[model samples]
Target: MKSREKAVRMTLVAASCVWLFGVPFAAHAQSRVTLSGIIDAGILYANNSGGHADWSTTSGQLTASRWIMTGSEDLGGGSHAIFRLMSPFNVQNGHGTGRAFNVAYVGLADDRFGTVTVGRQWDTTIDTVSGFASNETWAGYIGAHVGDADNTNASFKVSNTVKYASPQFAGLSFGATYGFSNQAAAADGSSGFANNRMMSAGAAYARGPFAAGIGFLQADRPDAQPAGALGAPGAGVYDDYENTFSGSIASTAGVQRQRIWLAGASYQFFGALTLGGMYSKTQYRYLDATALTLDNYEANLTWQITPAWETGVAYIRTSGRYSGSGTGDAEPGWDQINLGTEYAISKRTTLYLIGVAQQGRHAVAQIYGVTPSSTRRQLVVTSGIQHQF
Candidate 1:
């Protein structure tokens, strides 16, 4: 009788142990924090039509180096709280902590409802469709849409904003954002910095292998000029080649507004190859002035040579036109071709090579504030390695 009783107690203890530890372990497995980052560094060489051969070292030739921290806590009943903080940096010098300008936000997520975020963030057009083309991968310097003409990749981050994103269903999702001006009225009974406020909104949808999106952003011109000039005649306004120049006349004075539209599609041809293309356009309007329009198109192909090796080729073209009082009918345009290859040293490291060449017309001439000459052509070659953790 004593032996039998002891056996029964042992069985009960084992069952209690399973019940006490199993549920908590399963829940912990479903919630966790992840730290991820990438580092890309490379050497670069450039040749220009002016008989200047420039050899320079470069990094992040293929993709920007960045670090991200993300976490999610399950609230039970198919709901959760989530947050993410991502920072992009210059691998060469290890400075610039906020390339995305300090994206820190918190939101509630649900399996059925969607998500809402309040803080500094990117707009919908960029989050839905950017860097889907080969040009972004192959051409290092020439890939951006002519001065980031469209801001398609969220190159322009929004501040003091509230945003909402819908849950993806059947491969389709949508979102919108609003930024508050937060200003006080002026004594002249006129709007002061209040006029300098901004507002933006956008929507997007995706299904299967196709995606499309559009967004509009607007900002008021401050009476006081910021240090830099926009669309200036002799300044490297968009290229970041020179220091900020001060001017009295606001290039985008009054009310500044921008509208962007984009569409893209990708398809897998076989087990190892994929093809994709994208088109985007942006129109900028200055208070009572005619609009300036910029157009872009890109196409690319990627091939997997082996399980760990890949190569790609891409082409991109862009055109810009100005319509207003003093501007002439001349339009500028540029063409770029790029080739790139990559080998995965491991799951966390990669080596890459990229070559890019660009030829510009009237637009390229204005880009450098120089007369139109074949000497405007630029070629760049780069090779680097990247590690992710």
Candidate 2:
């Protein structure tokens, strides 16, 4: 294990050196490094959660507060080397106790060929079709589909991954990624082929005022590891990634595998209004059991009332189906509405307001990062501020 760890570390060091110093001998390359991030916090009111009206201070209601370091160097021949190191934190507590870099990758890019990178990073749903989903694009995790089952809001990042993105061709682009377990055998010294692995692929199109995307993702054993294991140093399988949004199926629900497909599209009108819609289906296959399926539908509109002010409203419907051995089929559904507005205080700062109302039928209400409601209804209202640099 130590030998493997040392090897991976050495490889990363070499790659970093190449990206930093491998410029052409005489081309006079130019390099740039930028520091950037967002900080957001607010007060939230919930009508029902654990059977009570609750009020609390919240962080990342509009965006996950994060800091990032991004750099790129021109390598001549229209190619460039790039890298990113991003860290996410809770602004309210000002503590970063988990993984050091939420995203860490090194890659090369060319206008004509494409780009390839390796590290912990987002999957295809987040890269492609998620852009048209209000919960992921604008409304935040609080507005995400039940348990974020489809990964539009990204339940977790893929670790030990290599990714490739193709250059656009006539308004079309495509990308894919693979995640590894980093271990050769299971605890019992057997092949770990079915333990931990992830893969995703997606494509997108944009032309004039219309854009659309489609994506597919599959992940195995996201929560196979126990708690108190994610924050440890060195390399581990599935432990280094945070799967906070996967509670519905990943938290001892006996889920063994997951698969998702999503598609979305949007249209712009008169440079002031945008309309978008998305659809997704996620399947949860359990160990020694049948499977569960979740279907989600969403539509939203964003209106730019002015250059500094904007508002968005969206509606979502989610349905779940259960199928198991010798068991009757059961179906449950949930409906949600989300409303939000943002006023730009400056180019890098804003004040925001958001509200969501959800109701479930033959289901329990569960919003991301919030306590599950005892009844079938939940409502959340939040007012906050965000700043970027």
Which candidate comes out best when scored by lDDT?
Answer: 2
Q: What lDDT, from 0 to 1, does candidate 1 have?
A: 0.58
Lowest summed lDDT across 10 adjacent residues in model 1 is found at 1-10
What C-alpha lDDT, on a 0 to 100 scale, does residue 356 get in candidate 1? 71
lDDT of 2 by residue, 1-389 (tens): 00001111112233444466584333234766656677879999988879998999987788777776777788999899999887878888998636678778899999999999988778766878988888765577788888777867665677778899999999999999887766567778887654567889999999999999999988776555332112112234223434432333322454577889999999999999999999999888776566788899999999999998988999999988878763356687899998988898777778988888898878777776678789999988889988776
RMSD (Å) of each candidate, 1 decimal: 11.8, 7.2
- Model 2 alpha-carbon miss at residue 246, Å: 5.2
lDDT of each prediction vs. the true structure?
0.58, 0.76
List residue ranges in candidate 1 displaced over 4 A: 1-31, 49-51, 97-101, 135-142, 185-255, 287-290, 365-374
Model 1 reaches what TM-score against the true structure?
A: 0.75
